[model samples]
Target chain A: MSFEPRIVGFLCNWCSYTGADLAGTARMKYAPNVMTVRVMCSGRVDPAFVLDSFRAGADGVLVCGCHFGDCHYVEGNHKCMRRIAITKRILKGMGIQPERLRLEWVSASEGARFQEVVDSFTEEIRALGPMRLKEWAFIPEQVEAAAAAHGE
Target chain B: MDKVKVTIDGQQIEVDDGSYVLEAAKSLGIEIPTLCYYPYMAPYAACRICCVEAHGVGGWSKIVTACNYPVWDGLEIYTDTPRVINARRTNLEMLMANCAPVPVLHRLAQQLGITEPRWKTDTNYTCILCGLCVRICDEVVGAHALAFINRGAKRDVSTPFQLDSESCILCGACAKNCPTGYIKMEEIENRYIVHKEMNLSPNAAITLPFRQAVPNVPQIVRENCIHYKTGGCMVCAKVCPKDCIDYGDRPKFEEVEVGAVVVATGFDSFDPSPMKQYGYGKYPNVISSEEFEVMNNAAGPTGGKIVMENGEEPRAIAILHCIGSRDHDYHKYCSRVCCMYSLKFSHLVKEKTSAEVYQLYIDMRAFGKGYEEFYERILDEGVNVIRGKGAEVVPSGYRQHEEGHLIVRCEDTLIGKYREIPVDMVILSTALEARQDAKEFGRKLNISTGADGWFIEAHPKLAPVSTTTEGIFLAGACQGAKDIPDSVAQGGAAAAQAMKLMAQGEVMMDAAYAVIDEAFCSGCKMCNDMCPYTAITFDDAKKVSVVNSALCKGCGTCVAACPAGAIMARNFTDEQIYAQIEGMLS
Candidate 1:
């Protein structure tokens, strides 16, 4: 409980980002557990971004934008979803919680939504604690010697 | 709360005492032809096609307008009869004698078996003087520029003292309200109907009405004329690559002859701006759902990137659902398109950058096929889905370490505590609203809409695309708020409806049109002057006014106003109606 959980977020330029502005204008406060990145569309968020965020020590990540059919890039959000599905399976195989990665859709006018997702996700990550998968150390010398013996 | 027993068409029925006959009939799935009876607006009873014979109080039967006439205990009503037919026919005949020569009226006249001359024609007649135009202009438009001038036979519609009244703001109230072509609408060939769609900017307003309007050419509203604002600004015309905008000229009417008409009028977006707490128009970054689409579009102002108006990419984003929808404060209907769209935006923002994404919604409605899987995928993609409606959008005005961004505040219901998260952006999934000009368009087509601005479908489930008008159909967002798949499906459905009519090679119209009573027609020609459709024609050889069956809409204005009771609507004879009244009375 004393340790801080790190969360990464990808917000669409149009709806979700403006929603964050609305939150600021309203003076609403939520957990400072999230780091954010802006993208033209949620659909444009490549799977690599989530994997990279995890590699960069993020315990959790969030993606948000306008509602479906309401996407700024038209069908960009749809593509983001398809790509996310593939990445979810890959993360599960990698011994990650998979729950640490999350996707949320927010619009520019939804400031309250911004607060809700951030506050909730932060708590969720806290419950799960820091991602220990990246923290695990492997004995590189032993693995190298074992690999050489097996090959020779 | 006791039910009132009433008899309609020889059947006893129970209805609420205060309910009108039309409402009662609707409850029983009865279709009644009516105009000037919009549910939102006050009933005028100007078009009396729904007139019925009712009795039971002292056995006294009388004809009454069904829309305004309330139901009573032991009341007997007759909707159809030989007598009713005569009255309906005679009324239609009178209306035809006065109507303008529009095709709809002529067709109605043909159905009623009226074609020959029966009354004298008036030469100096164009306006129908139906009083609908005047009332709607005053009541609906909230502008009193137009009024019926003069008195008796010399009565005419004018703006004040017959000159170009300065009070006439040219909002087109009189023209739009006109039942007849009396206040001729200024219809330029390429001019767009400005208020027909959701316009985010003044530029959008100017270019709203163009057909096939993707990147439509903009023109200055003549009344809100930028030239009038500053005395000389031709920026729109100058910037136009096609030289499509003509600033120096006023809108003019151009008549075109066509075998068919396709009404492709689109829909509008819900205005969340009125909910000032959201800070829609007040905030620079807080944009409408559609504006955000434009901002995120490659062809839009931002060239396909998620950024604030200041051109900086956001670090965090939040999406809110159900603006102007499923709320008692606004439309109490679930806008069938918001949920999936929220998911879509979530995926999009996450894919585009490393920013955190959050979806705030009252409910996660992924009922559509393959939608639930998509939702799960988005959740797995590291986007946070919060199950709660947003309470408010406020600015913490926090900057120092966050590069100046907004803080979103809300109670995460699942966790049972308030949360404030600083994010660079927020998005509101605003609901789709009805077109502002829906009423005007309905008037032109002699159709109606629901209490909300969406056009009323003939039947919600069975006839989703058809309208009250027999040949007309609705498609896309015009009928209601729907996703792309549904919109496209409706578009095809409407096309199929039109194709069905065209494939039949003939349109079967209402056979209850007007017929002239040659014996009673005093050759007064008053009816000839009042017809809006111009269905009546005077024969010099016959010395009597004639109606064209193929053009009459059966408005029945001339029938009631007729001094001689000469013309009548088919299936509505005076004698038959009198008999029905007598029968109801006893």
Candidate 2:
């Protein structure tokens, strides 16, 4: 069977979540690769929740928030922006392609933009293939064999 | 202005007493060439080439310049007399001796049958020193910035002391009137003079709105008018046939009683300066599609030439679509007219100039009839259509010296690679959004506006032209973003709806309204702020919010905001909503 990417999208309640509902109501077709989790606000998301989704075999994680200053709770999306920046670095240190994690902003009225961001991010993750931990784990013997293959 | 009789070449003619003999000769179809005479200015008979023999009533005759000689009663003028012809020939020979063989002089020399001047020819002198430009500058323009310097052998026209004078308004009157084409207006200061106060001014004070207009008459732009500025120059008033030109007339409000109102207030183009990355207001060549449209108009400043601000044709042009349309930060709705107009602009540029055209756009929505075919035709016309939103415009040229260019950055989504194109001009297809005073206008008309500031109609599909207000109707871009065809269709529908209401003498209101159950009511008053139409008001005596039934259309906002479940909309309750949900599930 061909490997289809399973992307977990964390959408906030005020902006990005309503943006997803707008995309559905507008009938704009996008890739059906993402499973959305509706949080109260983007600031309510924990960094540990991101690692848990990756551990649960999700190929990619999408964190969406309100645009800057458009948060329903005033500064909730600003907190999410800072948390996602740190989480991206943590994913990079764990030997996963940092391209698998994306932080986006979609206002309630931008249904077309939400669809575009979803389609493009899905295409990007598809090019990176599956996230297999066995293949990504760095062992000394495999590294030496890869180094010897280059005649180093 | 009094009339007088004068005889020219044995034909008697009546002319204005103060008018010159040249005008009388012109009226009589007698041609007498004069180099120093301009029609709009006072005549300086420096050339003496229009010499004619004037016979007094007492049979005495003498030679005189026909240009400035005033005509009187019983005055006989002979234009072909031998003495008059000899005087004109001698004057032309003396003027040609000092001036080089220019086209104006050569054309006159051919007519007079003069192969060469009798005196030595001086190739060093190109100017004929006729003082036509000097008289036009002093008498007509009222600016004495240019004057003749030195004397006799070294005479020349120049600015005061041959330096840039502060008195020079750069009006180019002297340069335009220079007969020998020796005068040119050079850039002695910051060349790009930005006139901030002018609004879409093609620089002419009086102009037609377009080539084909309803009234098809010229209107004066009072802002840039020289008569209004100096309190002089009543040239238009002097020439008006009906004498209907009134400079004192100003814009005023008019009151009219109407049975119905069609609110067809249109949209305004989104100003791209706030976007910042495209550098619209910062760069010289980065102009919005609205400005580009004006530049492409036949009667525009450059006469429809698609040229840069420097008056040079652009080598390449980049058209960026959806500038503020369909974007999260600016406007979420597409300005439906921009795509077709941008394509038309590309077609015009290709037809007019040999410039390379590039269009960067996201999702070309040519959904209208024959629009897709036009898009296909544009594709066949060699326009490079890149399916991506233009991200930035960076000035990347040393343009002051020569062909400077701007770099347009985009993703090029079809190729899945980031690309930057360098072009001489960038035309931003800006969006058409709601007018700034739309909300206030909606309030004055007792209509409701949506989040995007467009007046909300009764229903998008059924009652597209009807608003919640009974006698008021919506039309064109006032209701939503629409193209010309859709706006015309909706405007016609709105006009018919209004006429129907006017003819019927009444309008039917929506029967559904919200009511508050006083038994379960609390003094919360939160619904007063939540109601979009201001239909709910707090009663100070009862401490409970009351619903104005006459104003309510049962939008159900108070029903959802009521914490105690006090408000119940007519024909729409929680049970009814749940039943509708169940039906949808089925």
Candidate 3:
């Protein structure tokens, strides 16, 4: 069967969630690979959620909110940006591709843009194939050696 | 319960013990005239307008002011007897003589059946020694700017030293309370005189904010108002049809609890004064886009004629875009409205005046719907679209009538050469910046601001309107730079989000709140201080820290900071996090 990436999307209530609703209202066709969880804010999406999603066999995770200055909760997106940046680094250390996690800003008015983002992200994840956790065993020395080999 | 029986104006009335005679008479619906007896103020008893004959001890009747006189058991008060009327009439005549030309005193005299003052003085002083101004200044306002100066016949109200007192805040409280209107405030000779520098139409000191909004809603500009600055000039109040102008109106603070909050406090236009190359404030003809907007408005200074400060229409106009915007020196982000508004200005200039228009911009960004079409239409209208950032606006050295003419210097990058376009008026398309109070507002709401000072939303894309703080949302320019349509759409979206939450009836809090292990707790109170939301409270009697589930956001800051390992975040405990990592690898 063709790889259909199972992506967990944490969408903020104010901007990105509305953008998705707009996409649905507009009937703009896009990939249905992402299952959205409505969060009050992108800032509310703890790093643990992303880790938990990966452990639960999700191929990819998407965190979406308002643009930088356009955050509904002023500075919440900034905290999201910082936390996601750190999470990406941690993902890289864990022998996972940082590309598995994505943070995007889709304004409420950008319905078309939201469709484009989801389609493109789903395509990219499909090309990377599924993340099967049962195959890889975590050995501290081997992981360190692999990280050193990767120069990370 | 002892009650005092008092007969006022031939009507017997029962009153609470120790009630004043004025209170007793008021209970019986008997009218007692008073001037210097303001509510919540100490009675001065200066006017004596409420003089009434009270039956005294020894079968004698003495006239006393009803406002200050206390009622006693079996007291009989005559408000309008022949003796009382005569005494009141005599006092009214004396007051009329002292303040003859004053309208309020004249009205009081007419009511007392006195046509004119019986006694005349050479000075013709309007002060009746009511002492209302002096007493109010000291007691109510706390300014103590006025006092009863001199002694006996020479005693009059004056500020200490009779010079401009430094303590005077010029609140106009004393003038407002003056009974006879004897304290004359200096009136501006011509309040409708136009601002000289800008050459704009004359605006009343207190006038409607705009012609479109409610026609009669007047706002006072306290800085330019003579009444606010010098305790003079209440001409606007005197002429108002509704008599709604109140000098005593103070800012009132109110608190309200709501499920959601939408902050739409808009943006501030960037001032181009700091950009000396623009010569905005220094040159009379060089103006901001807002000034141009006003000049283009039909009800504006020149009645929508786009004329120069000297009242002459410009022969050529140069509109500069991205002023203090899209540059590392000022704002790094492109203020989205400037490009389109500059095009609009070009069209307006061409339509209103037969002037040659030039648009100087680094690049044309027509990203919005119908915006690119608008740009194309402006091009069709024969606007000279220059592909370069205007460097400097300088005075044209041409000798013949060079007053309004300015030389705009820029490199025509497309043509590979520098060009100096001489135009009569220069318009700067200034940037829109976050409001100066955005930081203070963010602090008040317990929300955080981005580095650029705009409110940071919960998520940049998904949660555009929602703040980090739940139940609060942002709309319009408060979030970022947005045009009217976008702002309105955001407003509707925010409203809908709030409605959705309200319709849900209950908010589902995160199940990851902190749980305290009471057995392992050492009774140390460190987590209480670490909680940013004040969710952790140390129970002094129980010697344990309690977590408020509703208030806690499950950030795990307290969990990590706990010394005893007593607190564990629900669903995010150390064991759960380790298990997730183990599951990720195996």
lDDT agreement with native, every candidate: 0.69, 0.80, 0.80
Stretches > 4 Å off in candidate 1: A1-152, B1-254, B309-312, B397-403, B537-545, B583-585
| Worst ten in a row by lDDT for model 3 chain A | A133-142
Q: Candidate 2 at residue B227, lDDT? A: 58
Q: Interface RMSD (Å) of model 2?
A: 12.6
* Candidates, DockQ: 0.01, 0.02, 0.05
Candidate 2 lDDT, B450-509, residue by residue in tens: 569887776567788987556789889988889888899988999998889888876566
Give all TM-scores, in the order shown: 0.45, 0.58, 0.54
State in Å the error of residue B291, model 2: 3.6
Off by over 4 Å in 3: A1-152, B1-205, B209-216, B220-243, B398-404, B538-543, B577-586
Sort candidate 3 into its docking category: incorrect
Over the stretch A1-152, how does candidate 2's per-residue lDDT look in tens digits? 97778888878765677788879988999989887876655754556657667766678888888776555444556767787888889988987777898989887667788899999999988999988853543545667877898899
Backbone clashes, candidate 3: 28
* Stronger candidate by DockQ (2 vs 3): 3
Candidate 1 residue-wise lDDT at B469: 58
Inter-residue clash pairs, candidate 2: none
Alpha-carbon shift of residue B271 in model 1 (angstroms): 3.5
